[model samples]
Target: MMKWACHRPLALVLGMAGLAFGAPGAEATESGASLYLLGSGGPGTAVMPPLEGLYFDKMVWVYDGSAEANRRIPVNGNITLGLDTTIVADFTTLLAVPSTNFLGGTLAVGVTMPLGAPIIDAEGLLTGPAGGTTLTGSLHDSALTTGDPVVLTQLGWQADKLHIQLSTMTNVPIGHYRESGLANLSLHRWAVDGSLALSWHDPESGWDISAKAGYTANGDNRDSGYDSGDEIHIEGAIEKALSPKFSLGIQGYYQKQVSDDRGMLGPFRGEVVAVGATAATTVMMAGVPATFRGRIMEEIDTTNRLEGTSFWLDFTVPIHMNMPAG
Candidate 1:
């Protein structure tokens, strides 16, 4: 028997969602897209799987957002006003956990590949050479393409009812991108993020609390001559197990840029706050245990970015498990 059967189902969902990135217009960074998805690390952030195995996770995300006419957004070496955008992306991730331990903790490695369709409708403006003349027009573009892949590594430690994890993720810019397209699915820049997560779970009381904080350092987009600044993100969740197989929770996140973007007309920092509800459950598929989770979030406040709502659906299953020899 696997050790996860005796533990809470939350352990099965850990580290999977946090590896997903790249949804344009859903959050904010350079060109109205970021390498770190805002609501990706909501619940079960610090827990590690009890059994060594290979796991597969699939996530479906949708977002619809818009910026007011008063704000300006830099995109494709041009500026846009009153940006309205919709994004739909799917992420497939694979996680591998070995039977070995490193530095007194469990080590895990994973990768996420994302495909996205982004639509943008906005008022466009282009300036001539040496700021000589200006052109204004309406722009609408849409594309279905692959986004950047993210690779991650994490170390997890457990102490009684508390769990902690340290993780690093890197974005590889081999996805589909066009320098002059408004509906590009990739950021076309290299970026790295480091995060720390903590979780307190009381099995007897069926209560779980988790929080994660991360920092992202972005590289310049050579195609657009844009240097995106660093960013900070914080996410938290609180949940109660209704039964051994089901749980419900509330989750929220805050994201803000810590520095200014270069090659833009003026200040181009972005910030947003969002809150939502999440639910998860465990089920059996083909005699193997599987987990399903869902979340919906609405942005309550935003600055220099789009304000919108997002929906997420995730499914995870262990493809192979290494049972301990008795």
Candidate 2:
């Protein structure tokens, strides 16, 4: 059996958590948000634990970006231009892997809950009561709120130096939401995502390469009468461990909308590409082994969305380990 880091299961759960909530974007969906957060999956995307156990993971994400002055963004039943946004959020995830196997693979289930606040500032042109009269105004909104929860299930298999996993995630739209609230945290709609991940790790050489691809299908928001289109995302990472406790890597992601969104000013489709650097290390926490990882990314290219930078910090710890009897 191949041995992964102590919290490989936790890393797997964290990747799925990115599929659960809406992330601030230029104008991907209603209010310039999307269900899938880009660049969420980095290294160790398909790695699973050799032993069955329970694990916990937490991630903090920060983003700052803005749309072009010519772009029109729909928010709170109004069209806005020169839109700028900032977001700070955290995701808490818990995962459980049983000793039992399904089809020669380990089966795991997990859940993630998110809490965040988004700040939005925009300038808009409004028509006055008088004909052909235009008024320019600015609006700013910010509030702390809770986001929708996500549930995940996956089956993983390891073959010598290679690992593969199949996973599915669902969004539960029961978080803080308001159709007219510019700073709301929830999308107020259901969504589902299916993904496949692959990893190649050489224990002797300390090299790891991983990739993940997923598709998201979104449902309509009845309150806003908006229907977001389907989307696809791909993420990849290449890492080399310099020492047992530390490693450095490069990661990137590509995201694009595959369908057209309804109830928008026009046929709104979003696309973006981002690349970044990542680092990871292992440490002991209260006598338990834990893993810490950080990443910073910048959007080099974008269309119909905001172009900005994002930072991520993640922590993973195994709560319990169930070793098989000899």
Candidate 3:
């Protein structure tokens, strides 16, 4: 018989994973539709001493194929010959600041390098002239590139229910734009995202509730004929612990368009509904504590303009600061 060690499920760990794969739709533009905050401020709310730490997050995205259409011309232009695959790498460094009174807040900023490639490798699809033959492979090939920087200011409030946090972030357009590849689809822009969440301690209740909302406003992507300026997103989640070291969480989100540059496109109204689940556990390496997490999400395409449906899978691992002295 094999012996198994039991571990207690932490609501904070499961909530953080829920936010990871919540929705890739147009949220508060932290990093092209993804949230910026890395981990939860559950127990790690204290202002740490100035020291260097390495934090990394990788997102592997594989998009389903769809047909490209022109609204005005009323024609199915071409099949999206390749998938839109994105791999983002973020390297984070934490800096400690002075704590005000009993509440502690930290200013941690990081830079992200987004790399992607269109699965279409064939060339010479759309070369020239009106209609340009194949609009699928006309543009340049997708490759690695640096895309905008994200700065995070997290405010941790020592509350009664749970440690509360208010994080503000910004996104700058410093990337390229390709017609058919991983290039950015929007122009230079900036946004602010805010979230309010709590981790409960009631073992009998066995459930946690968290709600977060975000807003975004910026320039337009005229070259691609898609206007993206004003947007709003609101989300709510319910999480429950199934057992020690394992749990399940569900989340739903809504996006509303505030304004429209519309550029040269058709109906600009867009909204998305997302449902997600997550699982987490602890993995000890060399006597050090590290948390491993996984999430699966499905998004409904309420708006007919964009892709009808999409799915995502993400993993997060949190590194404990208490390492053995060398």
Candidate 4:
């Protein structure tokens, strides 16, 4: 019997990291809503059911050094560390539908909470009024965001050797938008985002292929001086099954800045190239099957890609309450 009871929180952590990393790109508008929410939910990804809907997965995860950029500041020479950290938690519920066709689908609705902030640490840059030598200090109120509750809907289509999917999400600022906790940053507004994905399976060739794409738009920023812009990311992954219940996969994505304005804030722009791998397995508990999954992603700039890399891990186990005893 498998109990992924403790791994659910791991998925939330990874989702939060995505929210942080996706904020700085040249195309990221930094407009209305919170940028943190955008990162938690990747592009073109929806609530997908695992293992024929016997059970759905709920997950949470956290990792550092995922995507951090160090740059020189003009005034003091303090190195600005733009870091991304994320958290997400959601449940999957299977809908009622007759199984007449081998290729089937499911719908999942849940909330994604993302929180991110900027931490400025100074190096040997210039001098401040207090000292004639190098200055060191951290910026206050630099990190601002919310991990709002996003309503998600996903459609999955699977067959003998092929599967495809699409998903969409809308963020509702339900947490303490002005007060910060658990997630760090604070927010006071809402937003919306959408994504789509397609995957193929070939057991004969011992390989699996998938492609994904997505977009986001901020609604309203309560703090002012910042706006969220629309963004896009496309990725493909290949998988090789090691056993009936185990597999290893590698995925890569290209994220582009689609919007021009900085929303209400000044213009800051860049693009990203993401590469990563995943390991997954299936387990049975109480005569019911569940899935355990993990993933890590490394991101770099495409044009003048940054030097540092960001990484995170995700674990998921679906919970299906309505499935009849099999």
Clashes of each: 0, 2, 0, 42
State the C-alpha lDDT per candidate. 0.72, 0.73, 0.36, 0.43
TM-score of 2: 0.90
Ranking by lDDT: 2, 1, 4, 3
Candidate 1 ranges beyond 4 A from true positions: 1-28, 127-132
Clash pairs detected, candidate 3 = none
Shift in Å, residue 148, candidate 2: 0.4
In model 2, residue pairs whose N, Cα or C atoms come closer than 3 Å (at least 3 residues apart or on different chains), thus clashing, are: 26-305, 26-306
User: What is the per-residue lDDT of model 4 for residues 47-121, given as tens digits with 9 covering 90 to 100?
Assistant: 244433333334443334322344321211112234333333332322222232334565544545544453322
lDDT of 3 by residue, 86-159 (tens): 33332222222233333443333344344433222222233223434535443334444444454545455535
Q: What TM-scores do the predictions have?
A: 0.90, 0.90, 0.61, 0.65
Q: Candidate 2: lDDT over CA atoms?
A: 0.73
Candidate number of the best lDDT = 2
For candidate 1, give the lDDT. Answer: 0.72
Residue 162 error for model 4, in Å? 3.1
Which whole-number lDDT from 0 to 100 does residue 156 have in model 4? 69
Q: CA lDDT of 266 in candidate 2?
A: 48
Q: How accurate locally is residue 112 in candidate 4, as Cα lDDT from 0 to 100?
A: 50
Q: lDDT score of model 4?
A: 0.43
